[model samples]
Target: MKRFLLLACLSGLLSLGCAAQPAATNVPEAIRVEVTGKKNGRPLLLVPGYVAPGEVWREIAAELGRRYQCHVVTLAGTGGMAPLTVAPGASYYATYARALAAYVQQHHLQKPVLVAHQTGGMMALRAATDFPELFGGLILLEALPAPFAVHNPRLTPDSLKLPAREQLLSRLVSMAQGTFLQQQQMFISTWATDTLQQRRLLGWAAQADRTTWANIVYESMTTDLRPALPRLQVPVLLLGIWVAGKAVKPDLTHAQVQPLFERQLAGAGAGGEVRLHDTAREFIMLDDPRWTLTNIEQYLAAHPSKR
Candidate 1:
């Protein structure tokens, strides 16, 4: 799938001489934005999932770079970006969302299409909700409306609060202060499925600030975006991957999964579209890049934004 997607993207590209090549760009340090691709092409912002670096979009960016200006963002507390220190009582994700909007405005990107994954998708959704005029479209890769909403339908912030807060916080604090190996072990065991990917994610997580990481997770868990969905005006494409074999309900069928995602996203605005991909979990990009990229291309084509 990886090779196919790479070739497919490369084959579709017009000759480089046909269009002006992209130039490197320098962005402010408040939010980590790695700019690439044709300066004249339509802008596309890539946001990675939690604990993931902008590197997660490396292959996708390489392909999309041929046709669009790609802005790969690494939010504070994730990957190599340093934790964002905010005033007391401020939410980290909320602060990051505002900073991201500022980055878009500062760059003068006119209605850039936003492609985000997992937690990053949530952040982008919140930003778009708060600043509806800033974005042209949204593509959410395997994004959940609420974390663990699939496992428990009745889940809410009040019901989902983390138990043993002090103990968990202490553990995260120790992991932050501990050797790289300790932190890496915690990261890998919890998230990564591939060995090399595990190591790469670990390297970044080790550099992340513990308080920032813990706070974001807590915030993400408590955040419920269902209410804000109907308020959005931009087009949204949700690509969901359903692997029944890996599911807790191994016998789960698409019939069941589709409606669950729909229910979770029922409050989404009229512009929202939900698609289900039959593939494995954890590494959506690596496992089926072709399907992922093809859907993304279709979504972009449907949206048809111009810089």
Candidate 2:
């Protein structure tokens, strides 16, 4: 009876998972779910990072879709999509996880592989952990089970000091509430490029809801998923950037970050592997789409799923 009720609840949410597209050429450039690729191929879902649109997966999706059906998801409050309606003090990540899982069910996807970036990666991990049978595999790019834990595995959610978490949340909120120029500047510094086109793209990210962004960022930093990692039944692939050529302060070298990657893979049960790229930054898809596509194909081959 309990399982029946849960399925019923999920069925309702699936109805609102995505908006219908018109036959005419009036489809929204930015949407929740944009399907493309081979019509008779395996299903794969691409989830973009926080404050990023599904368009970020354009190049890779186009390539990967040639052999696989790609379902690109643009999270709400970013990329001109409507924000999820919620009351005060709601967990946006929880809402996103449900919406993503529903999207898979709604599309009748049979064990789709989930490829996610940053915060999307974290949400995908949560979804996979909760509903392991729904997915074939998972590929997380530069995601963290918990920021504090990645930096130091000795720290758990309970061991994390509240004052430090509060300060981090406060800073993230301030960044989210900053002006377009301020936000653009922040993006430029992190990405280390300020071309005219890049600035224009940053405009979309600048419009994200401050409250929603802050909530998810706070959750990703504070919520430790190490305990739930062992629950994952599907194959997991984690990719991290070395940033060897980039000029930055207190640069995170591969040697330093490799340990964190090892810890994550260790906690992710038996079906997981980690790969650290030499030159990619946060945006691995954009930095090296070929490498990303190749690795994904290899991983999918290793863990074949039936539809």
Candidate 3:
């Protein structure tokens, strides 16, 4: 009888141990934002490019957070946010922007400087144009103009048809299911210019869901921000990667891309300004966070509050 009692006690203990184990955390169903840095410092909002979650900005956020209030927002259907029930596309951009604007309003953030990358840059441009009162200035890293186009023979924009969306989604799922090394190699090949950036980006890319990844690329290729660029009312910064005399073909050169951006800025009539950085590309914050942060800090210092 004692043996039976001991066995039962052991079983109960095992069950208790099992129950104490922590369950996995569920990703949020909507947008998720993380705020860090000085509570009293000027507000600096970090906006990541399409498909990338707020994790991509960790390095920059960590550094910037020390001196400025940093708000890193992961759009709906990506990062820690829950996947969307609606088709993930350009409309998602508008939805995310509105949500972002609301977050700022709810928190009562002052006119914050928006720091954006790639497709995030496009979204920033849209937000700044549409909701000028919400922002103080704009910084675009590795920015592509509205009607963003890449002349690569290997890549073509997905068709507008619904079938194309399914095809793209399937490809993304397959890529996500690949071995870690395979996924890392794919990201490095596509975005990272050097080994260090490649390593960092690989980590960021791994955290994203396959569907979000596909949606970002599809939205980036199809959405045209050209019409809205000229309407932005804030100062702008354009940071780009400099590739000089490399045998390798770049997705787009600074010379080829800068003029397009400049033209759009001139037309926007917002009195927006553009500054070029040859040292970095689309992921400037990752490539050189210190430099990027310093530039942003200095720019904000020079531009007093318009609000």
RMSD of each: 10.6, 10.3, 15.2
Stretches > 4 Å off in candidate 1: 1-29, 151-154, 164-167, 176-194, 244-247
lDDT against the true structure, each candidate: 0.67, 0.68, 0.61
List residue ranges in candidate 2 displaced over 4 A: 1-31, 161-180, 187-189, 192-197, 244-252
* Candidate 1 lDDT over residue span 229-270, tens digit each: 877767788887666234245677767677777777777675
Backbone clashes in model 1: 0
Tell me the tens digit of each residue's lDDT in model 3 across 1-307.
0111112112222132111211222223446778898998888878887557788888888887787899887866555456654443445555556556666677788988888877677777766766766778888776554433333322234533333655756655664244534644533533545787677666555565656556555565566665566566677877665442122444545676456556655556456555555655446676667788788777778886665
lDDT (Cα, tens digit) per residue for candidate 2, span 1-307: 0111112112222123122221221123223898999997899989987777888899999998889999999988787777666445555565677677777766688889999988888888877876776888899877766655665778776775443434543554554334424534543534423364356456655666655665665566567777788878786898867563244435556777677677766877546788988866566777778899889999989888765
* Candidate 3 error regions (>4 Å): 1-28, 87-90, 147-163, 174-176, 179-190, 193-197, 244-257, 279-281
Residue 108, candidate 3: how far off, in angstroms? 1.3
At residue 274, candidate 3 shows an lDDT of 57
lDDT winner between 1 and 3, please give it: 1
> Worst lDDT window (10 residues) for model 3?
1-10
